[model samples]
Target: MKSRSPLVNRITIVVCAVVLTSIVSMATTLAVSKSIEGNATAINLAGALRMGAFRLLAQAAGPGDNHNTAEPNISSFLDKYEASLFDRLITRAIPRTADHPLTNQYRAITSYWETTLRPGLENHPQGSPVSVEMHANTETYVDSVNQLVSMLERRTEARIGLLHLIQIISLAFSILIIVALFVDLRNRVLKPLRKLVSIAGAVGEQDFSQKANMTGSDELAQLGSAFDQMSSELALTYYELEERARSKTEELEKSHAALQLLHTASRNLFANHDLCSGAVPMLQELEELLGIGPIRLYLHDKEAAEPVEVVTTASTDRPFYCRDHHCNACLVSPEDYDELPIEDNDGRRLLLPIRTPGKLLGTLEVWYPAETGLSDTARRLLEILSDQLATAIFLERQITEEQQLTLAEERTVIARELHDSLAQSLSYLKMQVARLRRLNIEGDQKSAHESILEELSTGLNSAYRQLRELLATFRLKLDTPDLATAMRKTIEEFSTRLGKPVGLNYNLPPQALSPNEEIHTLQIIREGLANAVKHADATEVIVEILFESPQVKAKIRDNGKGLPVGEQPVNHYGLVIMQDRARTLGGQIVVKNRDSGGVEVILTFVPKSRHLIPTEAPST
Candidate 1:
């Protein structure tokens, strides 16, 4: 890295170089002027004096008449001689200074002019004829004048040579300065700027790896460093973005896979109500999906409080167990459930909670024997799977309870029908038989016999009607999937049956229901809805069902005439049936006229599982 000048300094150097060159040239001109200052003027004056001397000599030789008319003559030799001697040019040429070489000669000439030459010229030079003495004096004066002119001419020629030499040196200096400035401009400014431009072009082409060679103290050098830094940072950012994008793509793939698993899991869970039958296979898939070691699920079926179940994907022996083997304490104890992820056995295992909003259904314990704990994507998938498993367990329990409830409801219907129809008919027939037994061969025998026949006919018809109704009730199976879907179907059915629209508001979480709560709820809602449609003559009917954690509430409202005044709802078979269903659910039903021109049927029940759904800690 060679040293370099700053831009300001470099510019200053070039300016100074040019300025110095100009000063040198100006100084050279001044030196030349000083060297030959008066030489040229003095030479001209000397030459004029010499020519006057020759002209005076010529005039003395006789241009007095005819020849003098052709050439000009020095008619007054003294006047001409004095004027040339006293002229500024002649004075300047001959010096009287002590250091001057011409001082004596100049003084001698002054003496000659004042004393000898002036006297001689004044006496005879006024149109005088030529003489030997005059001629000799003129020639001597002319010889002196020639000597002075020759010396002046010689000194002026020397000065001219000096001027030429000075000019040559100044020109060389100026050329050298300009060439130096040009080289400096190229090195300091142009080359570095080109480097920066090249780096910029590389970066514009998305080649972030290019860097400028930074090696000076100049502005261009600093700019090159800046370009290098910019490229470096861009390269880093580009790689970072690539890494992030790669990780994001991998995460998306994991999410897609997790979604596929959840979809299939939900489908299978819904298709089969027996939980453990699918649980083992699902746990196996989950273990493989996560690439973790074997996994186990601990379930607490609140219904069968005595026994806890642990389902495992791998058939390996259980490494650990609780002290209470029969009760399976580890599966049920609150301490065994971990809501937050925890690493065990040197961070190779995790225990996650299987929970819904209403209850803590189970615990999922997983391990990775060959590696550390699961990655974030794996953990998120596991959490989602835990939720699915919780719901699956809930659905399994609800299905079981629903099946039992349906059987029990059928039995209760049978008992109620038998009590309402067959028992009464049999009782009436027994009464008729007793009357027959008690009667003797009396006058009213025909009347007694006709009465007995009528009783028998009446009892048989009653039995037949009850049988038809019981058959109708038992012959149909529920067509819809879940309770909400069933309720929606029921409402739609009533809407069509009543020839108008029926509004339904149903909100129920998929959860386990009490012994007969599901069937009872559905039956009670149906009964209330039917009454609102057929009996109330409703123009609008709204059926609303909401299930809180432990309680189910339903309402059937109609914007129409309510029950007839002073009518007792207890007497109606539909109302009686609703009441019976509500009672079976451990709930109460109410039928009343609304102040707003309608009748509202309300039912509220705390289904048995409502007790099982852990109360929200008085906080939730």
Candidate 2:
């Protein structure tokens, strides 16, 4: 499915709002119906209690009793005891009609009780002789009331069922509408918007020739119109901006060119493969640029080692030397060397510290022969250039450190592989050779003995070749197709040691891997397969290699009991070693379980370094 555009997203939000409103409105209706049902149930329960009370009274009385009452006594008695009696009756039989369905039937029963039974109960006292007729008369009314209550319950259930059906239908319809809307918006709008966006992006890259032909006058059309207009205006403004920009750009370019020269000159000062050869040329350039009569560079040291005087020039006009006390400031803090009368004869001198990251690398001092002095820009620029030199020095140190790390990791891997596979095999061969030698020494010249000796010789040669090849694994100075071959042989040895069969399945074309990517791929594959064989308990493993331009993929799969959820293999040293190695190669690892069984581990490495490849070439 295509992603929704901003306009489609807005439409979706609006539709969602309408759907939510409908849902809330339905909820309100259901809530109101429930409230009304509660009230009706309460009324029904109250009526049931009143009617039940009257029926009980009538049952206690005999037939032929006068159950009717006169107006005054009934009215007065009702006013006093009707409410209290009703409460007592309900509190005993049915306290509330809430959640009960026979509400209407109970209401009718209560109405009949108020008009007929309550009046009689008020007018006649207990133990009245007129009770028999009252009992007979109310018996028929009781049967009718029971039937009515049953009907009311059935009707209540039906109504509730209907409401539930409406709710389900409402939800189903709303969901269907949303799904259809999304499909329509995706195909009709989102896909087209994406095409327009791509064209717009190209236009932004200053390809003003690119245009979007919006066929219809929809919102998308307006967007295309706005985009086209922007491109046209951008083209017109490009020339004006370019002219003004060129002036400023020229200034910027000039500044950049000057900075480049400064960087190059400063780099030459310390960029010695050997410091001894580069030092003199640095001082010569400095003297020529600054017009100083005499210059000297002193390297700062925390411990006393005779400071190497890198460069020195004799003053033609006057001799200037660092007084004994001035050397103290230069040694401890070159930044505070301003206290010294470092000025030249005409009051123009310059002192700069080549410092990086706290420690001082060195200091440069120039003695002017005339009144002219270095400007502020020149001073600031000199300090900046000094910093660049210091950084370069630091970088050179790091390159050495990194090379050592790479060599060390390579050595470790080679040593471990040899120790685990080739060494053990060689030891077995030695044991066989020793046994054959003992047999020959004993003078057992039987046919079997001769055959064994010949076999041992062949085995020794094979072991020799294998050991030499195993040692060659460490000699990988650059990533190549040969590295892949070495890695495959290593995996075979690993599988043999583990008593499992492993196969290498690849379709990598020739010259498909970069030097760095090739090394990273070898390492990741080595580690991944080793992990799977050791931990996954698989019988057979298949390794797949696919090379697509700009990306190369390697995957290892085994048909073993899959890894447990959230489980990772234990790495005693640290699991991060593999992860870090991958990151260094600008790659990542993904491990997952196949649906059938076992584990799958994949690694992808891409070159992100500009220094490693030609800039104009597309990624391979």
Candidate 3:
């Protein structure tokens, strides 16, 4: 459809109106000017005729003897006046209605000139009486001409006022038309443009609801339509972008939450040394973090032939017990299993196998709502948590085994001590008592019997003393797991018992020994202290434990009478035991008589591995 532009149409109408007003104004002005010109012309013609009649009269009355010439001049002036009057009357330059007397006077003048004055002038000479009468008529004619001229001047002034009035009306009309045009333009163009500008600003501010509702077929209307379309599209795109941003933000939050969950689970697992107790909090954390329910943990029990339920965040009604590894999800390795939640008879469940580098320890199982199963982040977090759990379990088991082994070794040491020292003494005592009884049965003499009884009593006392020492050795316990603390306690105990100040110089890092190593080391120190107190007759004792690169050296020295002269060191059971302990520690023991006075027992050993010293102390 070819629609006319409203702006163009409005402008065209305005132009036409202005042009029409201008034409009317021009025509009125021209008409006024023509009227004025005609009035002026008529006034001049009347004046000229009046002047000519006066001149003619003057020439006739001048006393000149040329009356024929004056008569000719009067005839010529009469003819000129008649022609001017005819022209003025014919052209109607002077309105007959308002100027009726003037017109009548002009007509009478012309009649008198043609009929009376002209004939008289033509017949008589200029000096005659008829000429004098003509001169009087000329003066009346001049007065009428002046009245006509004043009338014409008044008419011209009236025409000029009418022209001005018309021009004022035209100008007012033109101004009205122009004001209308301006209003039309303002309504049609400027107003809509301002509205469009406002809408554009609103769009820039991301407020797309505002619209340019201009209702016309003008260019501005088209622009508004295009703007509306653009706003709609921009709003749609903005909504899409907002949705995408929201989704991304949600995803990022989820990822951060998952990472936090993983971090917390890892910290819990590694923080607590007790696997069974530690796993509970980690499982609870996982449950809360993942928004799942009834999280359960299982540990493999080789003896039971089934995985044992170790910890649970919820009730134990839904235990995941798999003995034969029949459940695919439970037995699958972390790498082999896909991280998707599995659907079984008991709702959706995610199974993550807790594993270490050596073996799979168990499975961490969580039951979730079917509609909102596990997300990938949760699954991955569970996987990481499972690995940490497995590591914790492994460490706990290894520590337990080490403790058990240490206990067994202690038992062995006790058994060896009993066998080596107390057993021999008891056996000797039993032999002596039996001999004394036999001697008594034979009715030996009193002196011999008393002597044998004395020997048996001495052997029994030695046996009792050895048994007491064995008991004390077995009763020794480390106050703390660190070797240095235990050794200090031992030194303090011995010093108090011996009623002598026992000096100790300890300079080894804590946890420098395995449990078993610490047990052996403590036992050797105990025996050395006992030997020093009982046999060395030492007044002061100094115990020193020092570490050199890859080797630990311990020494017990006393200010006592040196070992008996010519005594073999290996002959002493206590020295032998210390040597055995040192050998067991992959080291050697030296018992030397110090030049000062006392005997010094020194042991030096290199650990099997430098890495045996734990970076962190073991929790009790």
Residue 101, model 1: lDDT of: 52
- Report the C-alpha lDDT of model 3 over 1-620, residue by residue, as the tens digit: 98678767778888998999999999989978876776766777766766766666665555544445544555565576567667844346755564576556556666666776556555556555544566666666667667767766777788989998999999899889988878887888788889889999999899999988667777888898999999999999999999989966875676687677667666766776534445555565556556665667787644334565656654312222211112122233444223333344335877888888878878888777687666776677677777777777778667755784677667768867787876787777777677767654446477787786777676576556656666676766654435755666787889888998899877654334666787788888888898888887888999888765447788999988878777664324667778889999999999888988899999888765332221221121
Q: Compute the lDDT for candidate 1.
A: 0.66
Candidate 3 lDDT score at position 399: 74
- Residue pairs in clash, model 3: 67-126
Estimate candidate 2's RMSD in Å: 43.6
The lDDT leader among the candidates is 3
Task: Give the top-scoring candidate (TM-score).
Answer: 1
Question: Candidate 1: where is the Cα deviation over 4 Å?
Answer: 1-5, 34-38, 48-79, 92-159, 271-352, 364-380, 400-620
TM-score of each: 0.49, 0.26, 0.45
lDDT-better candidate, 1 vs 2: 1
Candidate 3 Cα errors over 4 Å, as ranges: 1-431, 434-467, 565-571, 612-620
Model 2 misplaced stretches (Cα beyond 4 Å): 1-27, 30-34, 37-51, 62-111, 119-136, 147-166, 197-218, 225-620
Q: lDDT score of model 3?
A: 0.69
